[model samples]
Target: MPRITVAEQAGVGLDGAPRPSEDVVLVRPDAVIVLDGATSLRPELPSGGWYAHRLAGQLAEELAAHPDAALPDLLAGAIGTLAAAAGLTPGHSPSSTVALLRWTADRVDALVLGDSPVVAFGPDGPRVLADDRLAAVPRRGGGYRDRLRSGTGYGAGHLRALRAGGAAMDRLRNREGGFWIAEADPRAGHRARTARWPRSAVREVLMTTDGVSCAVDDYGIFPDWPAVLRHSVDKGLLSVLEMVRAAERTDPHGIRWPRPKPHDDQALVHVDFTEIPK
Candidate 1:
């Protein structure tokens, strides 16, 4: 069996309120899973943290029950479980950003729904697994008809739009327009999914909400994913969470941090995926 090590962090913002930023890394002999919940601006629906918690918990549960299942099937089951658990009412429903990783003997499989992204690092360099959509939900539709579906929400819609030739979505991602949606709706699907290059002994895997990604520049400096992973592995994920809290306290202006996104709820998980003999 391959050894898997995971570290995660989540914290409240200066607004003194809870934001949804959930993470999960399930280690199997062959694979691991990572999920993140996107934060939302709407007050009517369930908090992003609530949705992320449910999705990550349910994903972990389903994967545990059927360890050999495909990534899509597992995601479908998670959606059903989430819908059943939270009910279908849009006013008080759950939504989030989800990413899954399944490693096989000679290859690795990944599935992403919404903005929370999966980044894989090996001896070569870094490759992203998810769409990195700005927001996870749609905005045009409205009323009961716009109620988000069981398997979709802010993160999902945001990604779907990007994949559908929506220039705004692409520009938003490239220029750091921010990862959150101004509004929440069902039709707002971003990108459905993406895969990764097959490889063994993945050195590092990351699942993070939009908040953290927005902080990075083209070179990935100023708390880049790699740097974040190293810090987590050394000091512990909880310590990183505390660091975000402290950053909010000391550098609320973002003058020192100087990231595109000044502040918001943030969470991330770092996993070191070691190779195992088949």
Candidate 2:
């Protein structure tokens, strides 16, 4: 069997509230899953974190029951189950990003939706598999933090602006020239990027939510994906989280990165396959 380890932490919100992390990590004998819940703009419905937690639980159950189901089919089933339970309406519900890796005796498979990432370390080195179409959307100037500090401080106006922005972005999802995400729509799952590798060729794998990966993606804390993996293997994933927090602390005003929130929910799972018999 392969050896697997995981690390995660919830971050403080803009109001300094210690909310539950919106990320989920699940390690099964045959698969590893990581999910990142998107923050909700509307306060009426259950939070994105709540939706993500529920969805993750459902996915785990489904995957365990039918381990051989195709990845897209499993995701579709999970989305269908959750949409009914949460009374979610198409294009109007809280959603999450999905990153999954599954292995069999002969091969390994990976799928990524939204911005979450999966890194495969093989004989060729490290290959980062990420879906970054979300980053292509046209965003307004000034980060969410900047708007919060503007005058209202996350007041009704701020929320309205957020809702408007989200609505505008929704029109572009899962379409040509637009990005795809795992929402109430099962079709999004088909849009996810999937790849397979010979089991013997893969040495190890790493899966992470955008929060943890932002260190390399946004902060430039590490030189590359291999460095990030080496640091995680040596010092644990929390070390990377601390590095991100420290860097954000130095630029709380968004002068450096210009992000929405100071800190985000972080989660990571590392799978070591060396012990598995070749």
Best by TM-score: 2
Best candidate, lDDT:
2
What clash pairs does model 2 have?
Answer: none
Question: What is the alpha-carbon lDDT of model 2 when measured against the actual structure?
Answer: 0.81
The list of candidate 1 runs beyond 4 A from truth reads 17-31, 39-44, 65-68, 90-92, 135-191, 215-250, 253-266, 275-278
Please report, in order, the local distance difference test score of every candidate based on alpha carbons: 0.53, 0.81
Please identify model 2 stretches exceeding 4 Å from their true place. Answer: 140-161, 276-278
Per-residue lDDT of 1-278 in model 2, one digit per residue for the tens? Answer: 69887888888664556888888887777898899988876677677788888888888888898988888888888888888887887778888999989999999999998889999999998878888889877676654545755643444555566667777777886676888887788788888888889998799998989888888888999988899889988898789888888988887655566555667889988888986634
lDDT of 1 by residue, 1-278 (tens): 44454545444432434543344444555555554543433446566566666666676788789977766677766766666666744333545666677765567777776666778888877777666454443434422123223222324343343234333333343123434221122222233475756656477777665555544532133456677667767787666555665555565434344322234555566656564346
